[model samples]
Target chain A: MPTIFVYVDQFKGAALSASWETMGAAKKLAGEMGANVTALVFGHNVEGIAKESFAYGADSATLCDDPTLADFRAQPYAALLAKVCADGKPDVVLGPNTTRGRDLFGMAAALLGASAVADGIGLALKDGAVHVTRPAYAGKLLSTVVAKSRRPQMITLRPRAFPKPEAGAGASGSVTKVEPAMKEDDIATKVTGYSVEEGRVNLADARIIVSGGRGVGGPDGFAPVRELAATLGGAVGASRAAVDAGWIPYANQVGQTGRTVSPDLYVACGISGAIQHQAGMRTSKLIVAINKDAEAPIFKLARYGIVGDLFKILPALSAEFKKRLGK
Target chain B: MHVVACIKQTPDTAAKVEVKDGHVTWGDAALVVNPWDEYAVEEALRLKEKHEGKATAICMGPESAKEALKTCLAMGCDEAILISDPALKGSDSTATATVLAAAIRKMGDVDIAVFGKQAIDGDTGFTAVAVAATLGWNALTFLSKIESLDPAGKTIVVERSLEEGKQLCSSKLPAAISVVKDINEPRYPSFMGIRKAAKANVPVWSAADIGVEASQVGAAGSAVTWPEIYPLPAREGSVEILEGSPEEIAAKLADGLIAEKVI
Candidate 1:
């Protein structure tokens, strides 16, 4: 039987939730192609992650636990992954479409002399080949791509695109330990330090998002928007206009230039949706617009639009949500 | 301290793209340099000025892509080159990287290569790392700040802006770096620079000139193939505009969200 390899992306010791979603996708594709899913976990002292992969749908795992692989430098990680692929010769490889995942897959593909498809939202098996459905032109078009003649067809799935598999209790799978592909002295890139933002929910992983735009008036205008977001247990987002004005950090900006977000619900306050902004959030399952201007373009994409001052509507909305959701 | 900025021509972000007859098309929309690449070019120019070195802009596309190269020149690049050939049409990121790596090799002494975080067209954001891999150089991506550069010592330090946090990394020279928008504000082309760019000659390099074989580029050489394309289903555009007091509208919206189970 053919094997599909899933790269388990982890920071420190804990695996990213998206990695399990990727595993779920791989498992579904494996069933279609008569293949087994093998998780590839690479990190320092990450044996538990390999063991945990079995609960997330992996049939077996290959683990590379080494101090040299502790930090996410592309060279060592890709080298090890390429070595594994060379030895196992899997039919396909999958990973999460994050910074490290993209970097690692691209390098590994190059090392293996293969091509990689990025940001796949859907996957299917056609003629025993993996076909990926991915967004192009910033979600304006959908394209189905395939690695027709390549071995170990490489792909990275967009976060939240696939359902996370249910983790079963007492699941077990065989684990094969692997050695480091390169030494620490051979790698040129060094990770000096990291500065993580604390307490804020990641926008990409958020189920709900509350966004503000130019109509928020000033930096302080985000107060009401944040209140509603806090009440709803969602993340805060901003339009390019608000970000360019320095009212909020670029990390919070959702647009063609910034981050693309697909949440269960997106609340737009004072945002006049531009085509660029829509490119980021059009995939949202539900959109609610609260703007003083009825003619705002955001209302067109919203499921429910309120033509009123967001400063007033947001506070009331937060209170209403608190009472209804008992938050 | 020689710097090379890679750019591509793309439809304006505001342009409406559609699919017709199994092909993606942007009707009558003016094409411009990829917005992210403008920052790459600007950073290249800044580095050139700071180190008193040469800055060159390179692109891989059709003859029309020279227009993008000219934009880089107008923004003050010392030189520009276009790697274009009929055989290179529909080149994926890996194939494009192959051709670009060959050209970079032909250039002989490029200290650093800069690219945008991702292209607006394919949105893959894979070229820089792939090129680095092909060239066996350090791939530094999502850099928000170039903290230090020492040409004499052949070392560079940068801060990468990732989803989790800011990470400080150091790499040797002969590196490929992709920058984010937070790095710097791209400048508009000055009138004199525009005039110079309008008359500037951008040399086009064919596949043979870049020393890349026909089998290593374009669709035949690409690992990923787009066998099918279709437009995304149209969104339900009918919106229910709520008319009531703030509290009433909020209550109605809460009820609707609860009914939809999206709260």
Candidate 2:
């Protein structure tokens, strides 16, 4: 029987929500392959996360605790993960297809000489080997790939691609402590510090997103966009044009060249839907576009479209949502 | 100092994509350098200019990919190399990275390697880190700013853009770094440079030429197999356009969304 190890990623001492989603994918694939699932958590003094992994259907958990592992330095993390994979000799490894996952898993795959499939949206088993379906050409095409290499097929599941398994109360599992094989000189990268921008919700984690585009006019134009987002208890986003025009920061840009967002609801204001932008938000559950041009491309992809001046529409919508939601 | 920047030829960002015969076909779409890699090329040129080094453009693809290398050359890359092999069809990220790493080794004396955050086609963003690992070099990604570099000390510092914020990181020399668009604005290919690149003979290498085993490259070496190729799912239902005064339309849209419990 094959054993699967899923990395439980943490940010700022908290478990990334995508980690559970990855567990959901691993559990499904494990069932298909008749495999066992083990969760791997790494950090400084993160024993609690190892226990929490059990609630998400992990049969076992491993924790690697060290002061050097405190921050997410890529070299040390990759070295430590390579050591764990070498020691565990698992048949498969799963991780969330995020920034850190992309960096860590690639190095891990190279070290283990395993097959790597990053940004996997679909997983299945065929003839005792795993097959992954991932997007290519900027989500214009889906490519199903089967790794024909040795054991320990490593893959990173796209964020929110799989349903996050509900945590079970009092779920039981075993925990193991693994000694890392990292030398002090092996770490070539050091994270000196981090500074999180204040007063902004993460676009990836937001349930609703209100986005602006070039039509937002200027820096001050984001006021209404923010107001609508606030009224909806959501986050704010910007099109690459607005970002490039210096109207907003790149952190809020959503598109092929920017961040990919799959919010429950996406409200596009003054944005003409370019294929580049659509690639990022096409997976959203609902799309609403408000553009001045009646024939803008955004209407084709929007479930609800309103053609008008966004300056007049956005504020009104914000007010209406506030009155209707009574919040 | 010597740096290598890897580039890929991809369908333009706005091009319409289609799949035929279980394969992706570009269909008259202009082939251009991958948009993300533009930053990598830009950063490479800037670094070479600052450090008085040479930047070579390396790529693995069909012969047509030479067009992308030409663009890199036109953008001030000192030299261009293309890794092309008949046996290299359908190579995955691992195989491609393996080829790049081997090519870099053959070139020798590479102090730094650069790439974009992700290719616009695969959007995998795996090659840079994988290549770094394969070369036994450090990897840094999403770099927004290159603060300082002490080539003599073999140390470099940069700010990496994360979801939450920017992180200050330092890495050793002989590092592979992927740049975000904010790192630099890519310059357009000059007419003279384009003329030179068009006439420049980019050296092409096969699997054997790079000293890589055939089985370790192309489809045979790739772990992932693309069994099927298909278009994305179509959006369901029809769009409903609400028209009225801004206030009235807003009110109706809110009520409708509320009634559907989608807000």
Per-residue accuracy of model 1 over B17-128 as CA lDDT, tens digit each: 9888888788999889999999899999999998899999999999998988998999999999999999999788899999989999999999999999999879998899
List runs of model 2 lying over 4 Å from the truth: none
Residue-by-residue lDDT tens digits, candidate 1, A1-327:
999999999987889999999999999988888899999999998999999999998999999999999998988999899999999999999999999999999888988987699999999888888889998898878889988777888899998889898998899999999999999999989999998888778888899999999999999999999999999999999999999999999989898999988899999988899989998998899999988888988888889999988888999999999999987
All candidates' lDDT scores? 0.92, 0.89
Give candidate 1 misplaced runs (Cα > 4 Å). none
Best by DockQ: 1
The sequence of per-residue lDDT tens digits that candidate 2 reaches over residues A140-239 is: 7888877777668889988877888999999988899887667657788888998888877878777799999988899999999999999999999999
Error of 2 at B182 (Å): 0.8
Clashing pairs in 1: none
Q: How many clashes in each structure?
A: 0, 5
TM-score of 2: 0.97
